[model samples]
Target chain A: MAFRLIHASDLHLGRRFANIPQPPDGNIRGRLMEARHASISRIAKVAHDRNAKHILLAGDTFDTATPSDSVVRQALTAMGENADIHWWLLPGNHDNLKDAEPLWETITRDAPANVHALADASAVELAPKIFLFPCPVAFRSSGRDLTANLMDIPATKGALRIGLAHGGVVDLPTAVLTFRPTETVAPGSIILRLATGTDVSKSAIAHIIAAAPNRIGSSMDGAVSA
Target chain B: MTLEGPGAPPTVEEVETGAFLWINTELPLLPNTDCARALEAVLPDEGRRDILIRVRATGWASLQQQADLRQAAARLGPDFAHFDFDTNMLGTTYDDADLDDIDKAGALRLAANRLKEGTESETLSAEERAVSAGALARLYAYVKEAAE
Candidate 1:
């Protein structure tokens, strides 16, 4: 039994794009704004096509801490449309826990059955024998590594542990780093660069392909950048 | 029995069987006689076992006010089930009902300053420090916007 999932990050829905100067003629700003919302549907379609039951969004699902109510509701509706796909939303620097208290509260209150907000640092069962350790961002930045305690968390015997987090990997300067989700990186592997302004919309999608009997082994399966 | 701090005091199963009085530490000083009288008046109510007395503070107190508050706490210690003198400085009494824009802004500025200082205060526990840090981050964008 393969445990396949889609890994995505930095969707930044409800971004106004004020920094980017709009061209006079084409409604580029409106289209760009629409693209962010459209990306959710696109990701859903990909999940359907790939037959992946779970979509692990690493972090920064929204552009700002406080997005418009419409953005939140519509996004939930979109995910709700796809009842079978489990959408795990993680808090990132852009939509951190501290600044986005009401935003999270709204999500917690209104999210569909399919949507799971990764709002705390705890181990969650992704599937039978598959567990995810989420490192939710409390503030915009911190001196200590958020994922440092991943190794210390205990999981069921012979369970495949995957770490889901959103942050910059030390010494990595690239905009996006790709990893084969099924293949095990060496123990204590760091993944993904922090997504910044403007580049967040164009963020890459990393597919996680977990085949049967592949024990993630001692350390969490490093996060995928999408 | 007297209790201190926020939230409901332990149930009768958790603590001794007696009337529980929960007091907020930031409350203004009241005369010990008045406090005793109030407690005594409540003792006749057979149905209710717990009393919640909240004395809200209008602003940060002066040194004299702090001393008075401590003295009052000490005087009232014998009446409480648990007398905690260590004040948890998390409560506020500011009512926003009648405040105009200027007053609201002023209050925000004061709160931001207090949170900034509280983040650095060694007296604060780790949990309090974390809360202060979160509050500071939440206020940063607004403060920056106001400055601009």
Candidate 2:
């Protein structure tokens, strides 16, 4: 047995304050501005403490696509701790908020290997044991969803074959799946739902696809029935 | 070890002329950093040192304050550099509408310019330097003051 992967989603990093218009310079709206980093650090620490081999951050590391210096620094410091566990982060729509925000741009350019940002569909040999096939959300809002694209990869051979794409099957137009779902899924492959929480609408679309209910009222409570 | 030089310290009173600046950092960091503790004792590290000394007009010193703070930091020497929190975006928040293209471009420009100007004075032109410093002080004077 390798290491169990702790899959979490929708960490609205820098959204504690209202928006970019207010503290364009910087401010911790309430305690939450700092809490985002605190959340990430605790997550990293838990991942390591649990001996989790892999960490999947589906999207929206920063609350808005355009993050501030404080938010970026906080995330960096938090995520930097768990060098042992391989952390794979995808840029969802919020992270796609790059135009006005320079913070994410710098982060994309400067992230370490453990914190790999998936902008396109690719394959990662995660650790000594696992392999991850993922479709990273490059832009904020893509014309199509990521699940449809990743499921079309030609090869589907790995020990713990996993998929870390942005959306589920319901979100995308059926005409563009490239091939069929058989190209990616198996009984053993785990689908990690990493959604960027910019709005409820976008997440709802994602929720329907994976059949995981991560977007809309997605709770472990009734999630199995959902 | 003869530490004192010619103009180093004529007397104890003269050495006291050198000032120390304490800047408070509004960061949720785990405390117990000794150097910052000493500086924060007298002066507060409220937030961005660059924005504080350069931009915000507080009761004490203004951008005009840079001249004096720089001098003080110089006298204080390497000990001050220790308190320097490398805060590019120490604390930030975003909203819904910044999702627009135009808004993003403007925000990026502001951050990029701040980065380029804050760390690189010599590389920037006189016009660029003036813009970054928000004053007409020569690059030489700005750097010398900051180096202090």
Candidate 3:
């Protein structure tokens, strides 16, 4: 038998449309707010229609870490109405662990029996053999990767492991350069530093030096030749 | 209920009711001594029941709770703005600054100041520093939100 689950994220409940310009005649802001709440029922209906018992909300369920009590209660109540569908909530950068401690605590204390808040990095069994490894965000902007340890987590044999995480993929290349102080440099002397632990080849360094020859000293040419 | 002195234990009647008391074990007290007498003496009126105890919690878990409370107080509304602090450790008043009076930017500045002071202090343990760093990152997020 195959497991079915609905993947959704960034519901952003209680989000005030402060930036959007309000129309003089219509209540667009109110309509947007109502729409956010209405999405829950729509998603639940979709889950019910598709026979997906599990609804995995990746992250950012709330607009802010400290959403109003009414917003939190209303969302939980909406999710609670659909008892058959299980809602798995993960804290994203917006509602991280450090900033949204009370929010999670409130949900844990008052959420319906079907809702599960994945606040810890643990493997939860969604079905008989399907497991979900959730990487809940601790800080709003953790410089380090949150899912670095997903591969090391132990799981059952032949189990279908699914990793759920949220964050921007940083593709910037970084390199650490160390200066080799072999000779005493003068005021106008160019210092050659070697890039360590990076994929930048020696030819790249030579190309960079060749691009700017006036700034780079003649000693680097001899060093590169050696 | 009758009381002997400031450091005396609670009577049976008081204990039968929901009289909550917390005593620091590091002080000069006997084993298993309740601090109900001290707590009762400081009660301003009959309506107040909650007593804020300021203990020097050095463990990582305790620091994390403190950090969480501070963050919640800043992000949440006025309900969570009040917090207790140890004057000896923080060199401040018995209570934390009233975050309700200040705006969001002011609250963010206060959190930043705390993170800076914690980082500069050499006495903080590794766990304490880690918690402070997490708090600092959240502070950055708060600032970013304000800017947006």
- Candidate that would win on lDDT: 1
Q: Candidate 3 on B65-140: residue-level lDDT in tens?
A: 3333345434321211111322123211111232221233575567766875675568999668757755664555
DockQ of each: 0.01, 0.01, 0.01
**What local lDDT score does residue A84 receive in model 3, on the 0 to 100 scale?**
93
Q: For this target, which candidate reaches the highest TM-score against the unseen true structure?
A: 1
Docking class of 1: incorrect
DockQ of candidate 1 is 0.01
Query: Which DockQ-derived CAPRI band holds candidate 3?
Result: incorrect
- Native-structure RMSD, model 3: 28.8
Which regions in candidate 2 have their CA more than 4 angstroms from the true location? A19-28, A97-105, A156-159, A167-226, B1-148
Worst 10 residues of 2 chain A by lDDT: A203-212
Question: How does residue A72 of candidate 1 score in lDDT?
Answer: 93
Clashing pairs in 3: none
Residue-level lDDT of model 2, residues A1-226, one tens digit each, is: 3345655555667665342122444342444345445667666665666666676776665667666777776677567666777667766666663442465456667766567665556677665425567666666667775665544444434344345655433433342232222323442233322332222222112121111221222331112210
Task: Please give the interface root mean square deviation for model 3, in Å.
Answer: 38.2
Listed per prediction, chain B TM-scores read 0.27, 0.24, 0.28
Give Cα distance to truth, residue A210, candidate 3, Å. 47
What TM-score would every model get versus the actual structure?
A: 0.48, 0.44, 0.46
lDDT, candidates in the order shown: 0.54, 0.43, 0.51
